[model samples]
Target: MTPKHVQINKQIKLHFALLFVSCILATYLSGPSLSSMPLLQWLLTGLFFAGISVLPLLFFIPTVMAPNARNLSWLGFFLLAYLVWGVVKIFSPNGLIGGLLVCTFILTTFFYTVIWLRPLKKAAKARQQLEQD
Candidate 1:
C-alpha cells in the first residue's frame, strides 16, 4: 500500500482508540451513583453515535464527490465548527474533565483535517486549473 493509504489506516485506528478510551473513561468517571447513570448513558450513547457516524463520511464520501478543493474547504469549515463547539463546551461550568476531553478532540480533529484536506485541496485546485487552461 502507498504511504497515504498507510497514514489513513493509522488515523482510523487512532480515532477508534481515542473514541474507545474516551467512552470508557467517561463511564468510569461518572461513578456508580444513580444520579450519574443517566449522564453516563447519555455520554456513551453520544460517543457511540459520533464514532459510527464520522467513519463513513471521512472514508467514503470522497469516493462519490470527486474530491476537490471545495469539498476539502467545506470539510475544514466543519472541522473548525466542531472544534469551536468543543471549546464552548469546555468552557461551560459543567464541563471540567469534559473540557479536557474536548481539547483533545479538537487537537485530533484539527490534525486529521489538515492532513486529509491538504492533498485533496491541492489536487482539486490543480484539476480546476487544468480545466480552465
Candidate 2:
C-alpha cells in the first residue's frame, strides 16, 4: 500500500478505537445516574458515538486503502461536526469523568481531520514518477 493509504488506515483505526473507548467511558460514568434506564442510556450513548464515528467511516473504508483513492474531503465536514460537539462538551460544566470522555472525543476527531487532509494525489503522482524509472 502507498504511504498515504497507510496513514489513512492507521488514522481510521486509531479514531475508531478512541471512539469505542469514549463510548464505554461515557456509559460507565453516567451509569449510576441512569440506573432507572441503564440499558437504554448506555445503548444510546454507544449508538450516538457510533453514528458519528463509524457510520461515516463506511464511506471512507472502500477507498482508504487504495493507492488511487479519490479524495473524500466531504468526509472531513462530517467529522468536524463531531469536533464541534466535543468542544461544546469540554466547555460545558461536568465532573472529572466527563472531562476525560470529551478529551477522547477530541482526540478522535483531530486524528480524523488529519486523515481527511492527506495529500493523496500529490503523493500518488510522486510515487508514480519514481516507479517509472
Candidate 3:
C-alpha cells in the first residue's frame, strides 16, 4: 500500500480504538445514573448504547484499509452524528468522567474528519485529472 494508504489506515485504527474506549467509559461512568432506575435497567441501557457504539465498525471492518471516498463519506456522516450527540450531552449531570469521555469522542471525531478529508481531496483530484485526460 502507498504511504497515504497506510497513514489513513493508521488514523482509522486510532479513531476506531479511541471511539470504542470512549463508548465503554461512557457506559460504565454514566449508565448507572439513570435516575433511580433498577440495576438491570441500567445495565441494559449501557449495553444498548455499547451496541450502538460499535455499529460504525461494522462498515469500516469490511472495507479493509483502503475504503473508497463514498464509504469514508458515509463514516464521516456517522461520526458527525456522534460528535453532535456528544456536544448535546456535554452539559448533562454525568460527572467529570462522562465529560471527559464526551471530550474524547469529540476529539476523535475531529481527528477522523481530518484524516478522511485528505483521501476525499485526493479522490476529487484524481477525478479531475481523469476528466482532463
Backbone clashes counted, model 3: 0
Worst 10 residues of 3 by lDDT: 56-65
Question: Each model's C-alpha lDDT?
Answer: 0.54, 0.56, 0.68
Candidate ranking under lDDT, highest first, comes to 3, 2, 1
Error (Å) of candidate 3 at residue 2 is: 1.7
Model 3 whole-model lDDT (C-alpha atoms):
0.68
TM agreement with the true structure for every prediction:
0.52, 0.50, 0.67
TM-score of 3: 0.67
* Candidate maximizing lDDT: 3
Q: What is the lDDT of residue 121 in candidate 3?
A: 93
> Candidate 2 residues 1-133, lDDT tens each?
5676567667766665566566456534533455556688767865676456445446655444442333445445555665565566556554256546755755665565565555665777889999998
lDDT of 1 by residue, 35-109 (tens): 645886866765665565345335534521343445555655665665565566556565556546745754674
Q: Candidate 2 local accuracy as lDDT?
A: 0.56
lDDT of 2 at 42: 62
Model 2 Cα displacement at 119 (Å)? Answer: 2.8
